[model samples]
Target: MPVEPDCIVVGGGLAGLACARELACRGRSVRLLEAAAASGGRVATDTVDGFRIDRGFQVYLDAYPEGRRQLDLDALKLGRFEPGALVAEGRRLRRVTDPWRRPLAAVRSLVDGTVGLGDALRVARLRGELLGRMEAGGIDPDRPVAADERTTRAALEARGFSTRFIARFFEPFFGGVFLERGLDTAETVFEFTFAMFALGSACLPAGGMAAIPRQLASGLPADVVEVGTPVAAVEPVATVERGAVRLADGQRRACRAVVVATDRRAAERLLPPGSLPATDAGVTRGDKGARMVAFAAERSPIGGPTLLVSADRAGPIDNLTVPSDVVAGYAPAGAALIYASVRPDWAGDDAAAAADVLRQARGWFGSHVEQWRPLATLRIGHALPDESPAARRWRPTGPRLAPGLFICGDHVTSGSINGALVGGHRAAAAVDAELASG
Candidate 1:
């Protein structure tokens, strides 16, 4: 019989992969179990008729500290989007570029009334302030925000941003990021996100978002990461200092430590009833859902790789991007791929949702939008955890839940790719320390 592993990590997402990698690096024999056929939990990609469509419209910020530390970025050959976005105002599209990066375009925006002079100046000032704070280490997600910290909307208002500007720009731009148009996410998260965007490029790997997890998994031993292995529950061993994970197949595997790195819902079910706090207990609430509607086009609409956000409340689409424009590998030769994001509540079914999306796209791209072929409608029910101020209060739960049991995920840190990796690294450190002490 094969000897028992030192640790068994449940969940083959980024957190679980990172945890397993860190443990193996520390010279501990580790095994990672994933319930799905693939390693990436929420971060996945699918091939539809030669088009590489990610599970949703997602991007990776090069400046994410944890990502920089954990990922081999160069190998992924990332493709970057333009620094600014094209905002849909009525039938016309207004190009808004970052003043620091594209001064000439910023001037054009001011000339065309895309952004008022006052709001333009405030944007410059806010950029500098956020950069300075980031340099001073003011954007730590591990630390709790002050009780007086404001919401993203409140912070923008306090910073003298006009309500019109907030609704036209910040709402749709960041609303797509936080998955909420209210802009009620914590101000600290907003600050960190803004700083990262200002400091780095928003990019996609050549292979797609799934390439990230695949790269992480590639570094480990072939047998270390096991997909299609569903763990039923994590139970403590009565006669040993180790723990045992009961598999869905009724087999129990013993290990020195067990780390639950699944999503909030799965983690809650596998962990003991009282292990998590009351605020993090329920997963049905305090989660965000989104859908990605992909359409194949004969040619590019916007031309360049710029994200487009809908400022008009008259449309159901929040944002749209041509992935093939950013990365040619996203689609076949001579073809283009467009992805439009909408709230899960947009329509009753995929057909209705796709029709509504095309109706809105026609307004932005003219009648030619009707010619675009519908590819896929991907819906993510729990795309991200709640970033609201109330939800932020319960964020950053620790990794060590007991002597032989631990937990990690975006919920244990901030909600992002960086947060998941940070949680995994922290859990590995805690597990290493505990095992070494004994």
Candidate 2:
């Protein structure tokens, strides 16, 4: 008879893969099960007609501490975006570059009224403050909510940013990031994200976001992670001091411990009832949804890799970018790949959303927009966990749920690539300690 594995990791997403890698490194045998035909969970990509389309608009911040430690950055062949954004102001686009990075562009922004001198000074001060925080032990994923902590919008207002600046710049820029336009995400998350952008570049891997999970799984043994295997439930065998995971197909796999590294909803379903408290089980009131529509164009709209954010609230499109401008491989030879992010409210009807996006694109890119062919429309319901103040108040749940059952995911930490990796590492350490004590 074959020997059972030391641990079985449920969900082969980044968190699960990271957990399995850590366990294997500690000399424990691990088996990871994933329901999809491939891993990566929400961070997936599809190739259609020579255009690479990520499930939703996503980026890899090179400054993520866990990412720096876990991933081989150079191996992914990252394509970087310019340090600032192009704001759509009225009938024209205004270039806004980081003053610290590009003084010439910053001066031009001031001259063109993209940002007032006062706001420009405030930006410098904000950048310095965030960078200082990063240097001073970095942002803690599990930090308690400070008494003065407020919503992103409130925080910006407290920092003395004008209402016009908030709406013209911060709203559309971060609206796409948090998948919500209310700017209700926690202030800590906003600070952390700002620090990351200040410290490093926001990039896309040559092979799309899927390259991240693929690189993580590459270090593990071939038989360790099994895609297309859905885990039905996790049952603890107290008498034997072990656990068994039942698969959707009725097969049972026994292991010393089990790690539920799925998303918030899936994790709640797989674990036993009452295993998690109401706070942890319902940490996020609801998941944030997002939509992205990609079109194949013969020429680039912006002619560069900088992001274009719409300041107009009347339009459905929030932001636009040409992936091919950053990485040639994203589109076939001589073709440009345009990705337009639609407002969450507009994501319901694909046909309507695409039509509205095209209408708006025509305003920005002129009549040439008519020649752009639609490539794909991706509507992601669970694009990110809620990061509102109420949700963030609850600290991340500990990894251990029972003697042999544990859980880890982005929901258990802050919502980001770094948070998922941190959760995985923490869970692996907890499991290793429990097994060692026994």
The candidate scoring highest on lDDT is 1
lDDT tens digits, residues 1-438, model 1? Answer: 136888999999999999999998998889999999999888899999999999999999999999999999999899999998999877888998898898899999999899999999999999998899899887876456576778899999999999999999999898988888989878988888888889988899999999999999999988898788999988854445678889999998998999999988898888767676667454224688888899999998889899998887776788999989998699999999999998544555766888888888888889779779999998888888877777667654579888888988887777789888998999999999989998
The reply for model 2, stretches above 4 Å from the true place, is: 142-148, 236-240, 280-284
Clashes of each: 0, 0
- lDDT, candidates in the order shown: 0.87, 0.86
Please give, for residues 7-64, the per-residue lDDT of candidate 2 as tens digits: 8999988999999999989988889999999988888889999999999988899999
Lowest summed lDDT across 10 adjacent residues in model 1 is found at 277-286
Clashing pairs in 2: none
Which runs of model 1 end up more than 4 angstroms from their true locations? 236-240, 280-284, 344-348
Q: What TM-score would you give candidate 2 relative to the actual structure?
A: 0.95
